[model samples]
Target: MLSSFFTISLKPVTRPIFLYLLLLAVCTGGTTGELKAADNKALAADRKKVDSLNQLAFDQKRFDVAQALNNLFNAENLAIAGNYQKGLATTLFYEAGIYHQNGYDKKALATYYKSKLIFESLKDTLNMAIVNKEIATSLYASGQSGEAIQLYDESLTVFTKLKDQRQIANINNSLGLVQLDQRKYDIAEASFNKALALSIEIRHQYGEKKAYYNLGLLEEKRNNFARSEEYYLKSLAIDRLMNDKFGAALNHLQLASIHQQQGRSDASITDAKEAYSSAYVVSAYNLMKNASARVIDVYRQKNDILRASEWQDSLVNVLNMQIANEKEYALNFIEVIKNQNAKNTNAEKDLEKQKQVQKEQLLIITVGTFILIIVAVLAVLALVNYQRQRFFGKELKQKNEIIEKNSASLDQLNKEISHQNLLLEEDNKTKNKLLSIISHDLRTPLVNTKGVLNLVNQGMVPPEEADRLLQLLETQYLGTTSLLDNLLFWIKGQMDGKEDDKVKVGLHQLIKVLEEEHRMPLMKKKITLRNLVDRDLAIVTEKEMMRIVCRNLISNAVKFTNENGTIDITSRLGDDHCLYLAVKDNGIGMTKEAIEKVNAKQYYNTTGTSYEKGSGFGLMLCRDLISKAGGELIVESEPGKGSTFTIRMPLS
Candidate 1:
């Protein structure tokens, strides 16, 4: 019957025919039932044909062969009747490759491992190598770079022994990328250069381009800007020639960074926009988003407010487009899987009850037709969706590009405005200083002149009176000149941005000098002046600035105090390397609001009890000078109560 069947079916039966015939005899008691025998023979023959087709399809990268082989393996009675373990393993490996090609990495990984174990048991070295490479690739795709590197290394060793230079270069490129992630830049650069050299030697342009791209990234990390730029341009030229959109986009991004560092804002904006556009074409979301953001930053830094705002809006649109594309991809992939599974399940049930003879012959043809139809429909739908997404993404990207261009102009405007504001502030400070000098320095001499003139008008004395008046006039002129000199010195120091002359001065000595200067004025008001400054206390400050601060505080106290009122001057060492100097007076004090205003460093002025007029600049100058000497000026006053002014300075 086997011989007749081979003749009728026009198929050559190979090894295991006798064993299959013996099994048939045992099951049918040596029956010459040609139908059952032919059915068994036909089932084995179909399996062999499926295995042959599967091998051819895998070699040709045709996934439909896998579907046909899978259908044959699912034949329940036939699978059980014959030992199909070898055939099953082969089908599983091919199926895994198909899934991997389709980007179903996790599923491909699971299938690859299952086939790997089976092949290991069967001692299939060639299939094992193939499976390992696929598994490593899946690992890399899933972000397990460490594990992927190890696997790729192992596979590379095997392929190297097999004299597969193409696969070796491929593995080398992948390993270099892993090294880059580990921040082993030098090693990565060496690896990529070696790979590139090998690829050129072998005339593999694709591998050469990939190696150059990686080398460009390594040089960028090393801050070898000129070398990096050269490599990136080379990569870009190659990628463009090869029509590699993703690589081109990445190259543009690197070029943009170079422009940014060189302060070529317009060129940077142009490169960034091109990068974003190219990245969008390839769906490189991270690169696109980053380039968009860089354009925004450049515009903002240049003070181009309009351009900055425009790019910001463009960034939002790019983000939205990326999200929409991801959603569409996920949805399309899920829908394809669902329809395939439903068709597979229904086909399995239909084949289960078929008589073995008919089932074996019909199953392959039936399942192949069904799968082909489904795949065709899915491919069409996916193509349509891809077109839609790409169209919208391009539109959104163009809008963003326009925004980036406008932002560049706005940034320039902002820089101009900031420069103008700085100039305005400097001018205001100069005007304030001039007004202070005129109001405070000139008033003293004018008052003294008025007093002397009143005495002269009375004509109370003779030639001696005229001499006394001249002396008074000379004293007032000297006072006014001293005030003017101090004012001019402060103004020049401020204009030149000169820091104060810090030195260590004894607190006791400083207080005594100030007291001696104010003794006559204090005596005129009949105010008692007490000094409790520690002789041993010392402070680091600008000596002359400190003298001005102390002189102003004591002079104001003397002027404000009532007749017979007491004024106390004291210093104490405080914790944390500080010295506190206090000048307290029993005089007409200030209201709470007035004290607050004074403490807040706001302008506050009032005529003294002795009618001593002030510029209101005295305390402000004191505050400013004290702050420059690393000290603080604080005022404590209450309505109708005494006021205390304290100076806190860092101790030597």
Candidate 2:
């Protein structure tokens, strides 16, 4: 029967309406059987999420577009999980409506087109027409009237062929509104007349009421006051019977305006009062405000100042109430969201508990089965071993004792050889690294010291500038001494290792010596060094090794520190009863790759912040000595953020 009908030309649905109507008509298209039983858990969760999001969006009354989009996303995911193509198309259509309502015309049209294609493939003509109508309405909202008209004609043709009278009436009324707005009075009048006739034929209450209200608008715009009044009364009566407060409010407000125009102040005031009450019942705040203002105007037009003042006060009260209501509404929305989140959280917690319970049950069953199998196997093994032991236990003990002694001797000899080989390899590496350091770091300091001494001995240095040159010479001498100290100790360990001499060393005393040792060089560079280590905190470690470690850490901090930059030496006692000493500098730091290499104990060489050269052995030697004392070295740095090198040592 749908196919027997012919195509009919009609204008498109008006702007900003497809979204409202699409929301009214859409429902899920796929059956529950589309998903397998095993997939029910996931599908059920996705379905719940979709329903929750959709409800939030609807409850928000199009104010929350994000939630609407989120709902559409989950719906699509559910469709994919069930492999339901029709479900996906329906979901897309709903999502497009949301976008269209939110003024995302391009996105709305694209989404609707995707849904339309899918529906067409499924041979769903009704949905295809529906999607086309949405796209056409969105196009109209986007101001593409020519294309909108074309698509509307096509969609109308489809709906007409399907003999969907209700839909036909809707399209006619919407198109009539568009024609009226365009000021094509004759065309708009004809459209509304057709819609009214069709709506009455099908007894579609909403359509009939809408058509009457629109016809009233058309006749009023044409200055037909009596005719407009008749149309409006018919619409108003229908709205009251249907218990549509918003619709009734609109009709009453319109009737009030018509009465005001006809000079019936008393009747106009009555209708305006009724309209404000109805609008208030529906929480139509804008309508209430408008109706209250209209009532005040009707009294003012009657030249009754006192009555007009009373109505004006009422208008002010209505506005004040609307403001208060808006605030309450916002709070209610927040409460709703909070409640939803709490429910979801509780649901997830219950799911986790159920999963945990199932896991425990499975574990118990598995362990019990394993214990039974183990007991049976052990019983047989024990019986066999007891018989074999009775026959051979005495002979086996004497022979085993002899074989063990020889094996122990051979194992001890192998251990000694492996230990010696490790020492040799370590010694060779130490020698190569020391040579590399001495060639640069040691050589330059020694040469500077020598040159200073020659100048002093020959009296070439002036008396007035002698103190300053002596300070420079002293700095050079101290650096050379520190370098030689590290080389001698490292070499001695490899050649003839001895037990570390542990002593209670005060960090304050130790750091004081270090400060004095590096003071000349620091002064020359104008660098400030602060020692924040506690005076009473004493740590037990090899005295000489600890000194070398502290000296090296401080030296590196100062080396990398730019002129006038500050370095801080601080220490803290740790939970492990260890002392943590930090040498921090406010200067250039390390890049990620450089930090990785340093942490990995790879050979990392870089110039200092002031282009000061380094042997790079300072850090490596510090690491080795700290490890020998059962401590750790931690380096923290980033480019332009400065560095902190921390030494962790056992307490005394």
Candidate 3:
């Protein structure tokens, strides 16, 4: 009989012949006497083969999963060939167990159902109950806890009737976890206590450890920190005795979390480190990740940045290991699925190929007929398209001639329209400028004159103060007259569409004239105005335009100058052969935006430091005059520092 078993030569033979002989003897001893007929002997031998393979698979699964699965699949094939229904169901159950252990819950659930159906057909109640428990466990893992609880109850009832204390205790633990998840705390506690009492009664150390760990979780959830620690310590002691590093790691992590909840950070860190070490020893990547993260978090909460950074690196390494493990597990699962279904897949592919061959033959004949029809249609279309192209060609030539003639007329019209638009834009600008000046600047002098006359006529002014006020009024009136002259020149130049008259003007004389023009405001503000230009510094520019630019710049300086501030008008001939006339003032200066607006010749309004009023059109008009004179106006300013307004003009 042992020779017969060896002659079959089952693959993936990790164990010796003696091991198979031992399993065969244990499995077939009762059936050896019942083998009377030849068919009966063959059936018994097939059943023995399946049982031996299943036993071998179970033994191999601990260290070599692929080899284990291969053994189980071989067993499955043997059982199906022999019509050994019980053995086939058992093989499927083992396969599903493997899937569940490897974290393939959906596959596990599917395989479990297949096993359950077989067991039901055979009326194997105990095996069916076992399958139902596995299915429930898989469902719980997949987050279908409601369905899982119902199935668990059915399985628990069956096991209780069979007096299987081990299964009863396991089911109670599983039920407690579901209840705990649903937050039915008291119900969960009762279930966990039952599991604990039964596990202890049976002297099942592993079951007791699991029960203690679960109770620790329950107490932790209820915020009973001391009690949770007690249960976790009990679990830890059992884990140590069993030399289960994985279980020890989980218990330490739970203890660490409980310590953290109670604000015992130091104790929490110690426990977390212990957990990390234990998990590392077992190569438990997820547990190591959790332990490291807990340590990093506690260090961060303590405001220990250095310690946090150090542990964060460790956490990253652990996370990488976890990810790698997950990837490897996924790849192995795919391989397992392919290996399990390879025979069925091959049969289906063969059938599909035959169907595809018939489809292709019919398609080839249809496409050949369709291609002839398409060629006939294309020939007719080509003739029609060629005739249409000839007709359209003559029509396109006529349209092209007409378009050319129209395009010339359009071009002339566009040019005239553009020129008229430019003239209109210039006229609009001149109108806006004149209005701004009249309404804001010119009105001020007239209003001041009226107020002075009214006060004098009423005899409200004292004689001594009246003379000074009248002098101030006379100076204002003269300044207004000068502004009017400049405005008139500007308007005339715009109307004539010509540049202003330019001539060589002494820079020194120009500044001296401006000094006299702004004398009253200068005296009123007590600002010292200096004329630093060399008398020989002269350039050919429109004298009136230069005067207008210089006058406005000086007036602005006087208006903004604080009491006792200074104004300096200087000229220097640059190496670029340009006259740089600058009116620098130690007065309240412009912001960068204000200076940009001035340089860009944009019209804007702002009151001076002395609250002096203006049209805000001075800078625009001065820039226009300077540009027309073939020069550039440059402004530099800093808030509270001062400003320099420079006119750059070519000597030629």
The local distance difference test score of each candidate is: 0.76, 0.79, 0.85
lDDT of 1 by residue, 1-652 (tens): 9567545443323224445545754765545476678868887896776577566656645324334334433432233334466676776777677678767788889989988998899887666777787788788888888788888888888878888777777778878888988899878887888788888889887888888878888888888878888888888988898887778888888888988887888988988899988887767787888998989989987999898898898889888988897677567556655655776676556555545656765686567656654554355457658989899999999999999888987898899999999989967965886687686569757977887777777875677887877765764564465466557656755775676667888878988997876766676678988888888877777778778888878877877889899999998877777888999998888788887777766666788897866656667677877786778998888656788999988776
How do the residues 1-652 of candidate 2 rate in per-residue lDDT, one tens digit apiece?
4233211111122222445334433421133244445477776666666556555545644455455555556556556554567777887888778667645688778989999999998999988988887787887777777777777778789889999999888888878877887889999998888889999999999999999999999988988889998999999989988999899989889889999999998889899999999988877878988898898888778888898898788778888888897777556545544554575477557667878997997697567656655554455457658978876886798889989999999999999999999989976876787787878778778777778778887999797677777876776677678778878777665555576778888988899999998887688789999988899988777788888889988888888888999999998988998888999998888888987877777667777766766667678778877887778899999888799999988774
lDDT for residue 571 in candidate 2, whole number 0-100: 88
Q: Which pairs clash in the backbone of model 1? A: 302-411, 303-411, 304-410, 304-411, 305-410, 307-406, 307-407, 308-407
Q: How do the predictions measure up, each by TM-score?
A: 0.41, 0.54, 0.47
Writing each residue's lDDT as its tens digit, candidate 3 over 174-274 gives 99999999999999999989999999999888889999999999999888889999999999999999999999999999999988888899999999999
CA error at residue 1 for candidate 1, angstroms: 40
Deviating ranges (above 4 Å) for candidate 1: 1-108, 118-127, 137-146, 283-286, 347-652
Candidate 3 global lDDT: 0.85
For model 3 the TM-score comes to 0.47
Superposition TM-score, candidate 2 onto the true structure: 0.54
Candidate 2: stretches off by over 4 Å: 1-121, 131-154, 160-165, 172-205, 208-238, 250-275, 282-438, 446-470, 483-499, 526-528, 560-566, 584-611, 620-630, 634-644
* C-alpha lDDT (0 to 100) for residue 410 of candidate 2: 94
- By lDDT, the best candidate is 3
